[model samples]
Target: MRSTSQRSVVIIGGGISGLASAALLARDGYDVDLVEARDGFGGRAGRWERDGFRFDTGPSWYLMPEVFDHFFHLLGTSAAEQLDLERLIPGYRIFFEGHADPLDISASATENMERFEAVEAGAGHRLERYLDSAQRTYDIAVERFLYTSFDSARPFLSAEVVRRGPRLMQLLLEPLESFVARRFHDPRLRQILGYPAVFLGSSPGRTPSLYHLMSSLDLTGGVQYPHGGFAALIDAMVDLARAAGARLHAGTAATRIVTAPGGPGRARATARGVQVRDPAGEERTLDADVVVATADLHHVETTMLPRPLQTYPESWWRRRTSSPGGVLVMLGIRGELPQLPHHTLLFTRDWSANFGAIADGRVPSPASTYVCKPSATDSSVAPPGHENLFLLVPAPADPALGHGGEDGAGSSAVERIADEAIEQLGRWAGVGDLSDRVVVRRTVGPADFRDDLGAWRGGILGPAHTLRQSAFFRAGNASRRVDSLYYAGSSTIPGIGLPMCLISAEVLLKRLRGDHSPSRLPTPMSPSPSHRPPPEGTIRS
Candidate 1:
């Protein structure tokens, strides 16, 4: 057994959560090494470049800027000093199928209210009231729940939860769609309020109303973008981990988790290290006192560890609702798209039908697509006369629904879906012959997620944030079946999103430091209501 001073840590995966965990552990005097299966460190936030165009492969939206700031600040600097962030004006545009004009959601409350008034009478004031209630929900959730590791029910018994008990019950018990419908008369308004639920990988009707806090983050908190691309943020995280004395190894896949010998007399099995394979197909064993898995929880438990050491079995995972996967198309276009904003959403006429198709393990044709034209905000991503575009369509994560057979035929199916998505996007944006302008194109699908990132069921977002699968009900940061083993990332506590990943690292660090009560962790600053929009013209449908 190694002494506490000589203890070393091994982290699996080089995503934001893994990097953050390595940095914090290294700073705490533990010798740390992080292994990533992919050639890059960003995981889903990976990047690609070709023909002078850079595309952020995943996570284009930058919400909850303060969470990033707090994480960087813990490493002895500020996010502002490490990265250049620009706030997007009129945050995004939502285009309905038959509506002549798209609804623009502005950062400023006054502007958004005016737009709402144009649709339904007295809707502007109603939005304000709803947002106010949402703000309260946001505050309570952030301060009391988000940063904590709910190892027990003690935290929920706090005075704050008691005082806000009624409100919490209302939010948790109601469905997001029902909540929005009760508050807004117009379908557009309801869609605007309910659309954010997609971020949690569930339809509004299935998602809990407690997630309405996302609306506050989107409307009042404002959207932000890293200067170059999401890749820059990944670079910052890598630099921070390196500076903190953590060694990072890309292109190395962890094949097995080595554990201490267990028998009838042994109390529990302990994580000893990891067996890994390099890019050259060379396998090696790296010993460590502790192992932290920041990869997919299901993959780690089922593949890396022995079956008997698994805390969650295949049956357990099968019952949990996996989040939906996405068909992502990255295109480097030869010309500009004037109709597309920095972020644009084309919603179908029947949102229910779209949701139903996805639930039934099928891709929705004429899908509700999200288009990100980064060149509209950051010119550095593309060549002088070109535009960088990313299109994402929410689809089922079932391997059976994928185009080809699970093993090798899925790529072809992915391409067909991408082509169909491009056609749909062109029709919505009124840009005929979109394929002619595409000089470069790449497509990623469910099988890509499963093969590349080891995502369970090719789910891009991990487990869905259903009432039964959130907080304490979700996977724990520390493994119960093995000693000296911990977990982080979207699959664990604090749930999905980049902000939650950062918070998950914080939770893990607190547990390691013997601070079992994570409610004591410092709260990140929330956005104020004073974020006014810069002067920019709105793009209508």
Candidate 2:
């Protein structure tokens, strides 16, 4: 192990990945400093409050409780002790366009199977068998893939990987839609099994079957919600990082990554420090032995580093597929929404057409949308008589789509889309006169993501998880052109989602420590029902 004497590191972006990295490295004896451009440290998972209504700006669904538990355990504490989580039974309600009533997806595996049996004969048993296979795939991937940094192929050529070679190959070759289609005849069941891919910013037909582990994570593993909101988890992480001896700077934006002077003989540049602008617009340079960038991968490579020292070029990013951006509407309503559940999905009947429009760089006329009413579960988000509603509609990330007003009338463009989205939500999900009931309203589109978080192409989830952009094929965590520069975030290996961010941080930590042993996969554990919500006024945005 390297000596802890006077070693210092600088981390850019205070997202989940950056916070996790800073905390872990500090605990391991490195002096760490994290800088965030935003007023707060959550990045995409930031929070906002207006007129007594609190909203979690991003990532409402909390999946993979085990990942959170394991991360906290690594820090010598437990997630349960830091924050309270409630398993969302009947996790979400799904509404098909032509169907009369919605289908409720239960948290219990047995209940889910029974619901499947109700839909079609023997499908329940088939689902049971499918989840069994999915569980095994999840186990293998968590053990051999998700936690390791893919610097080379030698680690993957181990005896364990060779033994599971055939199964792995099969998973890699098949598409998620094809895999689900082969098993279930019911379109709704197939849709349920395949829709999880959308969360990864992929079409079911384009995503690899290796991602079917999500089904196991949803159906068997379960979906959870933090008591205060998703932002509560961010608070927990920030508290943990600060407690571990890392200094966090909010409202400080990194301008560029500085490097040692280069000459003809120096083939590789060495990272030295970072130049940053503080909240008051004052600029300064902070020196460090190593730098970790958890910001947008494209922004870091193209804008932060010098042209000659940059590893990935603009042309390379242009060739890669980026995930779709979204149009979000946050409405604080006057009264309760009796028809809507805590989580609801309104899927268009023409799923193919919807995906085609997004892929072809146009917003679909009638879009499938997701709605979250957190007040249904926890009333603290809003006043006693009101409800907090958040609606998300997926759209193409093309800048020309007028999301951020490239045409000079950006606010009007956003208003037009918001009008359509509200009408659709009212018509499909039974929210009557949604526009008139709205007391507080805020809209966020592709331009918001680009301006606020510096997301590449205004994409929310980073690069699309195409086969070529996943696992070992994704961007390496360590920089090839700069020796002491590294990356950790949704754009790097192991892919997106909150769990992946945590895993990305761990992977970077192991690489920095030169410890390549496989991470012990934590067995999936059910959240205890005994936990209670945090006391009022405990967690702040």
Model 1 stretches astray by more than 4 angstroms: 1-4, 262-267, 400-412, 519-541
Candidate 1 clashing pairs?
none
Show how many residue pairs clash in every candidate, following the order shown.
Answer: 0, 0
**Reference-based TM-score of each model:** 0.92, 0.93
The weakest ten consecutive residues by lDDT in model 2 span 524-533
For residues 303-387, what per-residue lDDT tens digits would candidate 2 score against the true structure? 8987788878798898898888788778888988878878988888888898889998888878888899999888889987999
Q: What is candidate 2's CA lDDT for residue 171?
A: 87
